[model samples]
Target: MEEQVNVPQIFATDPKLFRFLTKVIHDQGLTPGVEWKVCEGSSRGDNFIAVIKQVVHVAEGGTALNLLVKSAPRNAARRDAFGIREQFLNEIDVYEKAIPRLKSLVGFDLPVADLYGATSSHGEETILLADLKELGFCMADRRQGLSKEQCAAVLRALAQLHAASFALREGSPEEFAALAESVREMFWTQPRRHAFEPFMRNANKETLRLIREYYGSADCDNEYSRAFRQISDLGYDFLANIVTKVPENKKVLLHGDCWTNNLLFKTNDDGFVSAKLLDFQLARISAPMIDLIFFLFTSTKPKNVGNYLEEFLRVYYEEFERRLKTAGFTAAKLYPESELLADWIACVPYGLVVAGILAPALYCPDECLPNLESVKENSREAFVNEYGKVMRANTPESKEHLGQLVKLCVEREWLRILN
Candidate 1:
C-alpha cells in the first residue's frame, strides 16, 4: 500500500471517521489497504466542502484503482449562519431523486461520477461520487458568449429535459408530486421569499444606475428611464406570481437558477461541443416555461438573442408537446403550443429582472473586459458605457430582441411608457 501524504485539515481533524470511511470503501470490494487523499470544493461562506480520495487495489492483485469519497459537513452543530439546510442538503436530496429519473429517461451526455452512500456510526450521511475530469469534462468558458450554434444545442437539450420531467409528472403523478414536496423546504420557504426582497432592492438600485449610465441624460420621465422604472418596480411581483400564472394542473421540474454559470459546457479536441446542466442547488417544481424564458433572457447575447428567440420557442413547444404525448397526455389537454409564447410573454418581466443582473454582476473583473476597467475608472461616462451594453441596445440582434420584448411589455401595459 502507498503511504498517504498529509491530507488537508478538513480530513486531518477527523481521523477516526476517515478510517471508518476507508473501511466502507474496502467493503465495496477493494482490498484492505486503500490510501485516502483530500480534495477541495469552492467555498460558500462559512460551510466548506471536502472530498476523500481513496486508491483501491483489487484483492485479486492486478491493477490499482482510484475512487472519490465525499461527506457533507458531519458537524451537526455547524449549521446555523450559512443557511446550509435550505440550500446544500436540499440540493443533495433533489439530485438523488432527479438523477435516477433523468437517467432512466433521456440518458444525458454530461458525465456523472459514481454516487455511493455512506453513514457515520452516528447515522450522518456522506456521499462518494466519481469526479468529472476523470471522465473528460471541464467547466465552460464564460467569456465566450453563447454562439448561435451553441444556443441551438442547449435549446434542444432543454427540450429533452423539459419533456422528461413533464412526462414523469404526468405518468406518475403521486410519486412525482411527492418528490417535489420532499424538496419544498428549499423553494417554498419564507426565507427564500424574504431573501429576494433585500436582493431585489439592491438589484433595483444597481439596475437603475446601469440604465442611466447606458442611456444618455433624458428626463426622468423620458422613455428609457420610464421603462427601467416600470420593470424595476414590478420585479418582485413577477417573481412571486410565476407559480400562480403557469397553466393550471401543470408543473415540471424547473432549473430554478438557469444562468450561464450554472449550465456548464463540454468540449472535444475540436472546440465547444456540448453543454451540461449543473447547480441543482435551486432546482424546483415550477412552470416549464420558466426555465426556457430564464435561459433566453439571462444567458444569450443581446444581439443574437432576437434571431434565435422565435426559433427556440418553436423548438421547445414541439418537444414539450411530444414528450407530453409520450407520457400519455393529449396535445389538446396537456401543453398547448400556441399558449407557450403567451405563457412565455407573461413571464417576460421575470426575465428582465434576471437579465438586468448578468452583465454588471455576473462576470468578475477579469473575465468581462473593456467595461471591467470602466467600472474601476469610476467616471459617470464610464458607468454609462458599461450600463448601456444592456440599456441602449447595441447590436441589430439586440435591437430585434429588445424591440419585441418592449412591444410585448406595451401590449401587457407593463413598464407602459417604454411603449
Candidate 2:
C-alpha cells in the first residue's frame, strides 16, 4: 500500500482504506512522491452513509488534483443499523461492474461523476470518485427548490442514464442480466426491511403530525388526517412490493435516490451545460418511474408541481426517446407510451411511502440533522425515534412540500388515498 509513514494523517487513520485510495492515484499515472492533503468533503447532514473526504494533491510539475473519498463507518453498531454496508457494496458493485458496461454503450455521454476505484470486504468499504465540484458542477438548493430550467437539465441527464440501461439490456441480454444480478436492492430485503419497518411506520406518523401542524391547520375540512388514515391502513409490505417486484422486462438500474441534492448542475457563460448524478448508495434495479416520481415530488419545489407535473414528464420522455434512437436502438416501442404511463401509475404508491422520510430531510436545517460522521454521536437506532425532528423542529419547507405532494398525487389520480 505505498509506505504507511508517507500517508497523510487524515487518511492514515484508516490504513486499509488508505490502501484503496493510494491505488487510485497510482492508476491515474501519478508519481509516488506526489503531495496530498485531506479535508471535510461536504457539509453536515449533506452526507450520511460515509464520511466524505476530499484529497487534494499536487504533482512535482503537473496540475493539482482533487478527488472525493467515501469511507465506510468503522464502528459496527453504526454501520449495520440501516444496512449501510450493503448499500455501500451495492454502490461499489455498480461502479466496478455496471457503470463500465453501460458507459461502453453510451460512450462518455452518461453524466455520472468519474469512478476511480471501489473496495469492500470483511466490513471495510471505501470508494474513490471524481469530485464533481472540481468540474464546476454544484447542487441546487433543496429548500428553495429547483427552477423549471434546472429541473429540465436533471431530467435530461436522468434520461441519458436511463437510456443507457435500455441500450445495454437490448443489445446484450446476458451482460445486462449479469449487471442486474450484481446490484443488490438497498431496501426490501429480510433483516434490513424488518429493521426498517418500524422506522418507516414512525416516519409516516411524523408525516401525519407535520401535516396536522401545517396543512390541517389551514384547512376548514380535516382532509390531511382522513387521507393518511387510509394510507396507514394500506400497510408497509404492499408499498415495498410495488417498488421491488416489477413484472419482468420493466425495470432499470435506477439511481434509486434522485433528490435535488444528488442531482448536480454545471453552467457555462451561455447557460446550463450539464447535470451529473451523485450518490449511488441506494442504487437499485427498479421501475424507471420510481426514480421519476421520487425526483419530482420529494426533491422538487412544491410550487413547481401540482398542475405543472406533466411538463417535467414530457421533458424526460423527449430526451429519453432522442437518446434511444440516436444509440441505434428502437424508439418508443422499447417502452411503449401506454406501458410507461402504467408503470408510472404503479410507482406513485412507492413514492408516497418513501416521502415520509425523504420529504422531511429534503429541507431540514443543518442543525436539526444528526451528526453522522461520529458513530456514537448519532446512531441510526437512536435517531430512528425522532427521524424528522432535525434539531427538534421541522422546517416549514419540508412540511409544506410534503403536504402538497400528497394533494398533487391525489389530484392526478396517481395514488389512491381514501378519505
Candidate 3:
C-alpha cells in the first residue's frame, strides 16, 4: 500500500494541474510524496514558477527530488492582455522539440535547462523543468556585464547551440524544418511592431540629441555623423525592415533575446565554468549575427567590447567551426570567418538601435522603472512617455557607454560596411 500525500495550496488549488504534475514526478521515476513552494523572484511577466520538493518514504527512510514548475499566471485578464500567448507556445516548442533534436548530435551538450514536461491549452501553458539552481547555476548581475572568461564560456555555449542547428539542418532537414516552422517571430508581430515604432522614434530622437551635443553641427559632414543621421532619419522603417531581415546563407536558430537577464552562469574558484541560456519566448529563425550582435551590445560593458570584441568573435567562430567539423561538416564551405564578419558588420546599425532604446531602461534608477502594466494597457503612448522619463533619468555612465558604442562603430567602419 502507498501513502497518500497532501499537495500544498500553491499547486493544489487546481486538481487537474496537481494530478498532471504528480504524473510528471512519477514519470521521472520519483515516489509521490510531493511538497510545493513558490520560487523566489520567479513570478514575472505572464508566468508563475514554483519549486516542487518530493520526498519518498521507504524502508530505508526517504529520497528527494526537486523540480521547477512554470505556468501561466492565474489571473485570466493579465494572461490574456499582453498578446504573448504564442510566444509561450514557441518557448514550449523549443524545450520540447528543438532541444531534444539538437542534443541528438554527436558530442553536443545543449546548454539550456532540462525540461521534464510541458502542456498548454487555449492561452494557458505550463512547463516543468530541472531546477538549474539545484545544479549550481546562478545568474550574473544584470547591471554588470560578464567578465572575459565568463563571456568566453557563453560564446562557447552559443557556438554549440548554433552548430547543432546547422548539423540538424544538414543531417535531418525534415525534422529541422518542422521545428523551425513552429518558431514565431514574436518581436515583429503586428501588435509588437505597433508598440515598437513609437519607441524607435523616441530612441532615434534621443540618440541624435546626444550625438549632436557631443559632436556638434560642424561635424555633421563627417562619415560617422552622416551615417548616424541617415540611420536616425529612417527610424521606425529601418528598424522594422532592415533589422529583422534574415541573411540568406548564415541563418540559424536564434536565441532572439540574449540580454544579460536571460543568461545564467556558474562559477568556481578558477572562474566561470559553465553558462545556461534561458527565456526562449523570443526564439526565431534568423541570421546568427542577430543573436551575436544583440548579446554583445546589451550584455557587455563598453570597455569590454572595446578590448575584446574581435577576440570574442574569433572564439565564437572557432568553436562553431570545431563543432561543425565534429558533426562531419565543412565549416569553411558553409560559414567562413569572412562571411561571418561581413554579416556582423552589416548588423551594426541594428545593434545601435537596440542599444539606444535599451540603454535608458537598462540604466534607469529603480525608482524610475517604467510601469510595464501601463505599457501593456496602452503600448505606444505609455512607451513614449516612459522613454522620456528613462532618458531624463539616464546616468552619466550609461551616456558614456552609448558614446563609446558609436565611437567603436566608427572605428570599426561598420558605417562604411552599410554604405
For each candidate, how many residue pairs have backbone atoms clashing (under 3 Å)? 5, 2, 0
lDDT of 2 by residue, 98-148 (tens): 888888786546888888887787577888888888888887777777778
TM-score of each: 0.71, 0.91, 0.84
RMSD of 2: 2.7
- What is the Cα-based lDDT of residue 260 in candidate 2? 76
How far is each candidate from the true structure, as Cα RMSD in Å? 8.0, 2.7, 4.4
Q: Whole-model lDDT for model 2 versus the true structure?
A: 0.74
Cα lDDT of all candidates, in order?
0.55, 0.74, 0.70
What would you estimate as the lDDT of candidate 1? 0.55
Error of 3 at 342 (Å): 1.2
Residue 329 Cα positional deviation in candidate 2, in Å, after optimal superposition: 1.1
Better of 1 and 2 by TM-score: 2
Candidate 2 or 1, higher lDDT: 2
